[model samples]
Structures are given as C-alpha cells and as structure tokens.
Target chain A: MMHSRAPVNAVIMPRMTEAVVDVRELRKTFRVSEREEGLGATLRSFVSRHRKDVNAVAGITFRIEAGEVVGFLGPNGAGKTTTLKMLSGLLHPTAGEARVLEYVPWRRENAYLKSMTLLMGNRTQLVWDIPAADSFRVLQEIYRIPEEQFRATVKELTELLELGELVHKPVRNLSLGERMKVEFAAGLIHSPRVAFLDEPTIGLDISMQSRIRRFVAEYNRRNGATILLTSHYMDDVVALCKRVIVIHRGRLLYDGPLADLAERMAPYKIITATLHDGAASSADLDAYGTVVSREEGRVTIRVDRHVAPERTARLVNDLGDRLADISVEDPPIEEVIDRVFTSEQTTVSA
Target chain B: MIRIYRALLVAQIQAASQYRVQSILWMLFAVIRPVIFLAAWVAVARSQGGQIGAYDVRDFAAYYICLSLVINLVTSWNAYEFEFEVRMGRFSPKLLRPLHPIHYSVVENVVWKLTTIIPLGIILVFLALTFDARFRTTPAHILLFVPSVVLAAALSFLSSWVLATLAFWTTRVHAITTLWDRAGFIFAGQIAPLALLPGPLQAISLALPFGYVLGVPAEILRGGVSVSTALVLMGGQVFWVVVFYVALQRVWSVGVRQYSAVGA
Candidate 1:
C-alpha cells in the first residue's frame, strides 16, 4: 500500500504568465519508529527498535500563477499540510523540486523568506504576554521596514481588520478571533509577495469566518499577491478561490477551476420540487430521476447534469399545478469533493 | 542586525518586566545553593583552625559570594526552553521568520540577566556585609575581572545554545540538560572552589569549558589569581567561546536539516 502511487492530474497554466509558486513531483518521506503496546515488547524494543518509512507527501505537482487565490483542498492527512510546509520552507522535501518567486524554498535565503509568508491558524507568532502592537514593532525591526512604511502598513491592516483597540490588549487577553486577526496583520506587515495560509478559518464562528474570507479576498485584490489557502470549510473555498487543487492520499486527484470540479467528478445535478397537497411521492419522483430524498411535501432527485433541465421540465409538466415550487442546482462542493475521493479509491482498487 | 537585536531586546525587556516579582523570587532561589555551600565551607574552615588550603572563613565568604553573582550572570536555561518549544511545535513559527531563532533566545537571556541584576546585586552586598567577607582585590584584578566575566557570559550562553540545538533531533532533552547542569555544578566551582578540589579533579575542571564559565571569573573577582594568570585564563575563555560558537553553528545546521526532514 505504501508504494501504490496515484497519477497526478496536473493543472496547465496559461503561457502568458509565469508561475509565482511552482512545484514538480515534490515528495517527503519520513522514517517513523514503531513499537507495540506491551511491557515485554517495550523492554525488548529498547535493544532493537523497528522503523517504517511513511510517505507524508508522495510525488505531487501543481503551480499557481501570480495574483491567483487558489484553494488547496484535501481531507485530513491527505498531505496538504506537508506540501504547504515544503513550499513555505519549513520542511524539506525528500525528493523533487519546488520554487517560490524563482528561489529554491529549502535554501531558506533571507531574500526569499522576506518575500513570502506562511500563516497557520493553530499557530501564532505574537508574544503572548505583551500587546500585539509591541510584537509588530519587533517584526518591523526584524523585517527592517522603514518607519513610514511600517506605520502605513499597520494603519492599513488595522482599518481592514477592524482591529482598533484590540492591538493594544495583551495577546492572552484577546479572543481567539481577535488574536487571529492580529496574527494575520503581523504576517502581512512585510507585505509578502506570496502567502500560504493553512486552515485560516478552522475554528471561527460563521460571521467571523465570513469577515476573514472577505479580508483575504480584499488583501489579494489590493496586493496582487499569490495566495494558496487550505480550509475544511467549503464556504471559504467556494467564495474566495476560482481554482482549486485537490489532493488525496498523498496524490493529486484533481486540479482545475472550482466550477468544473462538480462537472468532472459528479457529472450530476440536483432538482427539488415542492408539491401541493403531497401530490408527488418518492415512487413518482423515481421515474424522473434517482429519488434523493422525500420529506414532507418536497421531493429531491439527482439527474445527469446534461439532462437536469429536461428532468425539471418533465416534472413541472407532469405535476402541473401540483408543482407549487421547483428548482434545479448543482451538487454542493463538499459532496462533489467527497465523491472525488471515494471514486479515486474505487479506481485505485480496480 | 543591530536594529533587530535592539528591537528584540526591547520586547523581551517589556515582557520580562511584567513578571518582576517572579524574577526576584527566582533570583533569590538561585542564591540558595551558593549560600548552603558557603555555610558548609565556613563551618569546615572553622573546624580546621580558621584556615583550610588558603581559605579562611572570610575568604570562603568572599569566594562563594562572588561565585553566586558570577553563576547568576552567566546562567542560561535555553536548553530546557528549546526542548519544550520543539515538543510543543512553538519553534515552527520561529523557523518561518527571516531571523535565526537563536537571536530570540539570546535576547531573552540578556533580559533575564538584566531584570535580576539589581536585586541580585543587593543580595550579594547583604551577604557580604552579613558574613564580614573581606576582598583582597587590586585595581588591575578589578579591570581584568570585567573582561573575565563578559567572556564567561559569552562562553556559558554559547555552550547552552549548542546543547539546545540537540532538541531538533530529540524531543526528550531533559536527561542531556540535567547531565550538563550536574557537570557544571561540580566543574564550574559551584559546589566548591576549583583550587580546593583534588589534583586530578582540578585538572579535569580546567580542561573542561565549565571551569571558565563560572569558576575562573569568580576566582579573578576575589583577587585569587595574578594578572598574568588572569590573562591566560581569559585566553582559555576566548578559545572555549570560539569552540562552542563553531560547534553551535555546525550543530544548528545539521539539526535544522534533521528537523526539516522529520518535521516539528
């Protein structure tokens, strides 16, 4: 199973633009020590321990053009974080190559580091006991930002994030959302050309998540920075990213525009009809398409994407006045991505 | 680089100032071991008819008093702190920064010393007056002691940083740091003056970097060594500083590679 590598569905970039972040077959394999749960085994293992090679990031490849906000989508342990770490220069790849802004990431040169930023939602660089503004000053010095530029950037971030007095409070005293806003501001203080954001909205309330999503979109618009964002929240991806790269089990499963993902993976659409006087039953809907659900007076069915309009028209004509309300829509992005992973499994097993 | 260091120093000082009471308590706690050693040595000297190997009660008082201050000035807890940072994944953010993470540690150490210095100085003065300790120091010895203490601080910090880099390879650095502190306790003349140790042990202490970290500086401050001897010891301190610095750089490069390969 460890050696069962999946083929990559590479995304082709336009020839007119140079890729800001380029990766080719980037991989990272880790040797992990293993031990069984037993005192005798533990005692014996002290003398001769066992280890296994686990490929956290199998040979996967993709590219992002400048000013593009691309979603890096994958489930847990799908090597999404590993690939981001490699691209951000926090982890070295065991093989293959990656370059950000034409600099080899693993070299970790000052110029390269200065031009990029990686923000992990669960981690923070702010000093816990002090006000976040103090930490920003330290970062200003570390990045050697001039006084005028530093003040201007801070003012801009404060206005954009709505962090008026929050920056003055000790970081430990601030709420998680407020702290994250400051973390984002601190990361952007240098105005990096490339940003890798890992789960930026992992545990925020819905309203806060919307605010952050908007901030990211606006930041990208203003700076023209290339952003690679990963989030389990499908809303973030659907709202902010026009294109997405989906990886599964250390392999690139699909990479294309977010709109095309459902067409390619699901190739189906959903149609819902609210009938009057409970006129249509599940049995009646099955004739039109696959009955997805029948709750109360409404019936939902799945049909081929190309036949969705025909299915809807037939339902309206057959039911006539009984069809009080009707609508046809594409499947949710989450369901499409789930099918992508499950179908890939079927293909691999076959 | 200077701007970065200054900024880091200001930030660390501000953070440390918030815990002034805790800092004072920790500094007082550090005085305990030296005070115990001082009492024991003074007792031993009194029992041995007011003198034992050139150290009378007053001399023991002066020696241990200076030893306490010197140890406090040069001590670094970075090995333990680094281990915790690595285990908790706190080091990852530091790695992402353009500056080396060691600069943070270095600045934190300096701030810790700065915050504790005035209080520790008062404690040292009180001990000196309480014990009626007399110093036999010349102007020349005082001048040389300045450089000796500075060199000692550099050597001690670099050595601790070198040990701290081991955290990249192993999460459990407690045992290693424990062993290091134990060796430093004996060989750095924390428990006793290096001159009073057995011939073989004294030679071993001199051969190790620990002696230069605390022992030699304390001895110099107490006016126990000649000017030429002090210069020679300073040279040794310089050599160990260079050695530890080179070792730190080499170990850090290798350790970061290991970290990047295996991850935090």
Candidate 2:
C-alpha cells in the first residue's frame, strides 16, 4: 500500500524516513520538435520549430522500504526507464520530489552516490578495451572501497556469479551474458545500499537470466539492500520480486503483490486433460471450454475460475472412459498482464 | 582523489595499449605534419640565402621538431570523444558515477599522450639528427618548459572540454572543433615562428592563449625568450588556465543540465 506524507515541514522532515526510496509525484517531460520528412520541410522547421511536450513520467507516487525488492513493470515507452533514471540521479525530475536514503537524488551528494548504483542492460560502463577486473579496480578507487572489503566483495560476487576468468577478458571480447555478469560485479564492487536495475537481463539466455535472478536474490538476502528492478521478462519479476508496480502510459495502473494482480485481472484457470490411448481428437473437447491447445493426447482449455472445479468434475464424469488425467491451474502471468493492459485500453477508450 | 586518478590513468593506458595500432597511426599523423612544415620552411630558407626570420635551415628543423613535441604533449581529442559519447548515449553511464565525467576525459587524454610520446620522441630525435638541428635549452629554460607544457596541456584539455559541451546542444560539434583546431594551429606557431608573423598578428598571438600552448614552449626550448620574458609567458599561461577552468565548470554545469533535460 502507498501512503501520503504530511505537507508540514516536508523540507526539514523527509517523507517516509524509513523508506529507502521515497518518490512523490515524480514526473519528466521532453519537448520534442515536429519536423516533416522532406528537405524543404526540414529547412522550414529550422526557421519555425513546432515543439510538443511529451510527458515521459506523469505524477506517480510510490515508496520502497529498505531490503524490499520491488518490480517496476511497464511496456516500452511506458516511462519505466525514465523513472529509474530519475531515482538514480542520471536525470533530474521535471517536477515532484524523490529521496533515496534521505538525500535528494538529483543533488547527487557524495554519500548518496556512494550508497547506490544503476545498471542498464544493453549499455555498458566498463572500459571496453580493458579487462573487467581493471574496471573493477577503478571502481574500487573511485568509491574508496577498503582493500580488504573490495577483495572480499570481489571474491563473493565472483563466486556467486561463477565468473571464472570472465573478469580477465577484455569487455569487448566477452559475450553478452558474460558481459552482463561482469557489469553486475562492476556495479557492486562497492556493495551499494540501493540498486536501480533497468532491464538487467534483457538479452541474456534463460539459464544466465536465472543465475542472475538467483544472485540478485542472494545479494538482497545477504546484504539487506533495497532493489528496484524493471524487466519485460515476467519470469524475472515472478522469481525475484513479491511486489510489483504496474504502470502504463506514464500512469500507475496497479500496485500490489504479483499474485493479487493476477487474481484481480484474470479470474480464470486452465484445465489440461489427457485422452486415454489418444482416442479423441482435440476438436472433440471444444464443447467443454475454450480449447487452448491440443498436443499429443493432452488438451488444455480455459475455464472461469469460479466454475473450474465444477467443470473439471463434470468433465471427469462425462469422459470417465476416455480421460486419463486432468489438472487445474491458474492462467500464466503473461496472459494476466495482457488482460490488464486490455482492460486499461477499454477504460481509456470509454 | 590521487588514487582514483592513478587507477583511471592506468586503465586508460591499458585501453590505449589494446588499440596500439591505432595509437601508432595517430602518432604518425602528428609526426608527418611537423615534418612537412619543416621541409617547406627549409626550402624557403635555402631560397632566401640560408636564412628566414632569424632561423636558418637547421634552426627551422629544430623549431618544427620541437613544435611537434609540444603539440604532442598538449593536444587533446576530447571534443571528438565527447561528441561520440553524447551521440551514442554513452554519457548516461558516465553521469551515474560519483566522479565528474571530465576526469575520465582528462585521464584518457593524459594516458594517450603519455603512451604516444615515446614514439613521437624517437621521431623527433631521428629528424633532429638527420637535419643537424640544434636546441639552445639551458637548465632554466628546461625548468620553464616543464611548467609551460603542463599548463598548455591543462589549457588544451579544459578548452576542449568546454567545446565538447556544445554536443549537448547540437550535433555539429565536429565543425566547431575543426575551426578551433585551425585557429590553434595557425596562431600557435605550428605553421611558422611567432616572431615572423606580421606585427598585428604577433600581437594577437601573444594576447591569445593559443600561442603559449606550442609557440612559447618551442621558443623557450630554442632559447628565444629571456628569463623575465619566460616568466611573463608562463604567467600568461596560468591566466588562461584559470580562465579555461572557470569556463569548463560553467559549460559542464549548463551542458549536463541540458543533457539531462534532453535525455542524451
């Protein structure tokens, strides 16, 4: 749940002192010029620019407490990355207030900077021509990490990520997954207190993504650091975060536990049944419910959550001789999210 | 801060080493420019009865060799790097660090020049020996040249950084930097001796910081300036140092704000 802080003496008293990240009405807007696609129109635009303001992040408020791993969910162009940039001090918000560890992020005070890190997938901060270890050393110096602590952190991260010899190779020579691992190590050389990860596993293989997810979870458990992660992959969120904040078109759509979101948006279950001896075709099961798929002898159907049990019982009795096995389960998270977005579209159009 | 700088410098040098072929090619470019100028000036001196503007053929050789060294020590390509970084969205990662991004440029420039200086020095010596060029450096002149070269490098880097900040506003930064480089070369005595220029042009060179970058250092090494003149020239270099420092700060602050607003 989100809470509103009192307005009195807000400057002297930071809102949500207990929260590691406190954001209120955070907003960012860009004034982009509209230019026609022609040489003459381009020249005309130079003389008379037509600028339109696009709000990348509207007034959205949320707080993340210490040690909490919060998932930031949004589609492309939904302001997720913009919000992360603001929280990490890369971009100052056009309006609204944000405090990380009780310091205004835009101020970027040394203590604040030393206590946090931002990692963006598909972008690298490492020196591409040198080994990642060398960049790690640079970070150690820049963050003033104590030698013993730096060594220990390096060892721990290396072990966790199984980064054997990957740190020794030049970043340009490393594969995407290897590079991402090194990036994580580089960003964590100082063991920052808060990590803002934007699409950190975007291009990694499934196994590599799972490894990173496990490492993140372990890091949070061991250090109790706060984390804010944004990813298009639902598995990343489902595995690493219990709570998720869904945003669309720079607006907050929902904020709660992941399971609650699925329940609220998708009130249905999938019924997968196996035909004995492959006796029945997939078309024969359409009378039961919406047929999702029929592969081999198994058929999957979607049924209303409230009537799923009754429907399964009727199917079992009706197909007693033909059915081999049946199971009922919640719909996949992707489908739930699709429903959420579809519902939001309906509300917008309405 | 010192430790951080050392680490950054080491990393940059390692990066340069990784691209050694490119570094050597860049050094060759630097060497060729001065050699070309030396050949033209030597021809002109021989045509004019072995002397032109107080420099004989051998003296011209020495002047150009020393000019090449000074240019190598002071020149920085940070403007180009900054333009590329801004265009490619590389500045976003740099902005997240606690250290100011300018330090990265500074370290890269210093390390790159340091790594390239050995090859440049060998070329200078080869030209000096081949052309029978002589330098008139005393211990005092040498001492003055040290500070002069250091200040020139700082001025060059700061000025380049200031120009690089233009990338925050427009994509045509390359043209602006090219114009600045032309001004630097023409006025900084890369083409000819500062004293050989017309009176008004020499005055402009003396008044501007560009001449102090290469021409003054070359003059000091060539025993052209008296002790008093050397000190005055060094003072002028320090003045520009302060001016460029302030300009860098102003430009970086404004530029970063603009960059953040524009998301580049």
Candidate 3:
C-alpha cells in the first residue's frame, strides 16, 4: 500500500474488465466446539457443549488477473490455506464476495469446477490402492476431458515432471516426491484456467522442488492460467513470483512486489569485506557497522541501505590497503520477511 | 453422462479386483451366515417331524438361498463407507469433483454385487441340488423378479444414503445401522419366510419397506406369490423408493450445509 511500489500496481490491477479471480472482504469463521478432558466433562458435553467462534479470514480483499502468478505468503495458521479453500469452492465464506471466472465458487457449478483446480500439499486426492494412471483416467471422466485432449495433456505433463513409469505404479508404492508429481499431473490434466496451489512443493527434495516449480511456471506460461501459490519456502516465492501478498494473523499486512517489500521492511543491507590479515581489527568490527560475522580475513557488516555506498567508500578509504575485497548486497528475502512479521506496525498506509 | 457413469462403475470394479483376497472372503462370509441358518432350520424341521408353520426342510432351503441372493443384491454399505471417509477427511476430494460424491458409493455398491454374482449363483445351485429343493421358476415370475431386484437396489441405496448423511452431524451411526439391519432381518423375512411368521408380524412385514427390499423379491423368486400380489409388492417397492428418494434429497441438502459450515 506504500508509495514504494504504487506505480507497479497500475500495470497489474484489473479494472472493470472481469478479473480471473476477485475476492472482497472475504471472511470465514469456524465455530469450534470445546470440551474438557474428563469423564464428567464428556458427560456434560453430551447435554450442553461449549463452542467458540474462530475467525479464519477477517475481511481480506485481493484481485488476480489472467496469467498472473501471485505469491500468497503468511506464517503458520495465518489463514492462507483457509482463504484458498474459500476460493476453490471447498469452504464457503462466512461473509464477503468472491468470484472466480465471474462465478461464485461455492455454488460449485460444473462449468466453474471444470475451469479451476486446487492442489493442497497435505491432501492426496488419488486413490492409494490403484495406479495413478487409473486415477488419471477417472479424472478424465470427471472433468469430461476429451480422450485426445486428456492424452496430450498427460503426455506434456509427464515429460515436464519427468514422470516415466511412476504413473503406472500404485500411489502407495511411490515415494512422497513421486506421489506429489502424480498429484500435480492429475491437477493439470484438465488444463484448468485458474489454479490454487497451497504448498505444492512441500516435502520434496531441493531438486524436485525446483523441478515442480519449473513445471508450474511452464504450465502457466503455456496456458496463460492464473495461479495463487502459498508456500513456507521463500525460495519458491522469490523465484516464481515478482509480486507477493503477505498476511499475518488473518490480516493482510502488505501487498506489493517482492523487491518493494524487502526495501520497505528491511532498511539494512549486508556488506562483506575481505580485510588485510595484518591490519584487520577482529575484536571490534562493530565499530564500523553491526558485525554480522568475522572469520578468515572476512568481515561482514550490516549497515543502513541508504548509507551503504557512503559507508563502503569511507571504510575502504579508512582501511586503505587493509580492505582486500568489499561488496554490498541486500539482505536475503527470508530475513526481510522475518523482520516484517516482527515489526509492530505491519499495516503501512499506502 | 452415461459414459461417465460407465467409467465410474468400471473403475470401481477394477479397484475392487485389486482386493482379491478381501472379495473372496466377503463372498465366503455372505454364504456362511445363510448356510448356518439353513442348517439350524433343517435340524428344527427334522425335530418337528415334517414342517413348522408350513415350511418343510426343502422350503426352508429354497427360502434361505433366495434370501441370501436378495440381501446381497439389495443391501448397500454406503453408510459405513461414508462414515470412514468422513473421519479420514477423504470426502473432501470427492466434493471437489464436478459430480456428486454419492455416485462413487453407488458405483462401488454395484461393482461389489457384480463381483460376487458368480459365487452367489454357485451357492444357489449348490443349495438347490444338495437339499433337493424344487427350484421352479415361472416365466412371468422371472420377468417380474428383474424389476423387483433393481427397485430393491435403489430403495436400499436411497435409505442407506439417508442414514449415511448422518455422518455430517456425528461420527457414530453404527447403532442406527445395526438396528436397521436387525429390523430388516426380523421383519423382512430374512430369518424366515413372511408366511411362516405370526399373522400380526406378516401384516407388519407387508406394510414396511424392508419387506419390499428383501422378502418380496425372495418370495417372487420362490414362485409362491400370485401375479396380483407381485404387482402390489412392486407398487410398494416403488412407493418406498419415492419416499426414500425424497428423504434422501432433504437429508442431503441439510447434511451438505452442515458439512460446508464445518469443513468436509
């Protein structure tokens, strides 16, 4: 909401034209029944149960255009999954308006369902005892995908995900990564125009995660499908999403480009300098800036971003021959996100 | 729509074939109960010196054999499956599909019957030969039996589906299902032919839907009921089908609202 990236919003925001996904003041409250842990309490619950309302989503608004891949990042239990459920027609909203492809998702009309897909990392929709190939055939019938279209999509997904013999084996027989690949393939068999992917790369090895990410990116590129992805791994969001919407405690804290978020939340840059062995003052590196680390003639400093250039110049001049190699870089996006969550003023008026 | 249903049914059949051992055990289990009842009734008839309430040993054999077949064809385990899947959170995926989740259970029920049909037929022939039971089948009765069986399947499924939706409210519906099964067993003539029951119980059986599901079809197959009686029974089956179908629709709307309010 800040002026930091306000100009970028103009290019991304869909106006009167129908956005692929539009959500406004969406809310979902769950009435969780509570019970005491004792025989007497259990008996009492049978007569009169205690219940409390927990608001999972508290009036959040966002819109996504066609072919846009937006990163939806939040801490654990921050309502990311719950919000996705509402958008995908799995859970109805307690209040607020949500439309996907101009259709109210909770109605779950066949046309709405055929046009979108939701892939939750923790849930497996494939039948465990049967081969995934058979499950794909079932999906084909469910989505009513023509035989040739289904076959072509499967072939392309198989090649992209490197799924050779994995589809033919029982899902239980496959490893976690293998099963995840099949789940991805099943979600894409219909070539849905909009996809809600929650933690799609969860539990995969690093290489497999990158492969899956690449596949998602390629799928979006080919189909111009709109996607909203949620992940705990910053690498996924950082690599795949230029724009990110961060929410905390069921509230939208920030929505802007990743670079703008890093700049706004994290005002500091990391400066690493290779110091001369003889002239290096190891014990008091903080005198120059906040000492991040000092090891093997290398001294890292955390300095204000705006003053990084001046600070580096002064350090080089003051150290003279003592500084061997010096470099300044922005803090990692993960650290910036950590700072954003810890900051007291999360809702920056933009 | 027909192609989708066919694919669903075929998938379930193939999926069931994977559990070959369980399927065989299920077939054996289905036969064991009726065979035990047949033995007990035959012993009782022998002790009674000829017949009890107009049912001789051969009559009891024919009755039990037909009861087994009717029960197998009509009964559905949708309630049990729904209970398990709801608890496991597996029902959510079914909801995401464009089709209704009940289709999965219906197809599963049909596939199970198809898989066990050969064994059920073998058991029927074995019972007829071993007990020297006169398995007479009239052309009219056979023709009537087909629709009766199909209607019975629909009635059972709709009734059980109504009970299955109870999972949306509470996890435990075993007691409900058990009471239903026992009621059907006692009143629907699965334990004994309707004619063998007391006069009052026979009237109750005729009035209730359970009798239409199992006892009526079994009677038609046994060649005892008249054509007019068969028509009345068929009418009763259709009546119950309409009643349960409406009940199922009403229950489903309320249950899905509950499920959506809570997470499925």
Model 3 misplaced stretches (Cα beyond 4 Å): A1-16, A276-280, A295-297, A344-350, B171-175, B198-207, B260-264
lDDT of 1 by residue, B49-123 (tens): 989898899999999999999888889889888888887778888888889998898899889988998989998
Window of ten residues with lowest summed lDDT in model 2 chain B:
B255-264
Against the true structure, what is model 1's DockQ?
Answer: 0.66
* lDDT string, candidate 3, A1-350, tens digits: 11122211223334557688888878888788999899999999999999998777877777888898999988887789889888888777889999999999988898998999999886788988888898898889889999999899999999999999999998989999999999999888889999999999998899989998998899889889999999999999987898888876666777777878877888889999888773257565676689887788888899998988898888888878877899998898889878877763343442
Query: Which residue ranges in model 1 land beyond 4 Å of their true spot?
Result: A3-17, A279-282, B260-264
- Please, what are the lDDT tens digits per residue for candidate 2 over residues A1-350? 12233321111223455988988888888777898899999999878999988888887788888999999987788889889888988777889999999999877788888999998887888999999999999999989999999999999999999999999999999999999999999988889999999899998999999999999999999999999999999999999998888887777777777877767778889999999857355566777789988888998999888889999999999888888899998898888878877776666666
TM-score values for chain B across all models: 0.96, 0.96, 0.94
Order by DockQ, highest first: 1, 2, 3
Whole-model lDDT, model 2: 0.86
Of candidates 2 and 1, the better by DockQ: 1
Give the best candidate by DockQ: 1
Model 3 scores a C-alpha lDDT of 0.84
List model 2 lDDT by residue over B1-264, tens digit each.
Answer: 999999998898888887898998998998898899899999999999999877898888888888888888889999999888887778877777788888898888788788888888888899999999977778999888888889988888888888999888784499999999999878999888898888888899989988988898888887777878999998999999999999988887776666642332
Put the candidates in lDDT order, highest first: 1, 2, 3
Better of 2 and 3 by DockQ: 2
Weakest 10 consecutive residues, lDDT, candidate 1 chain A? A1-10
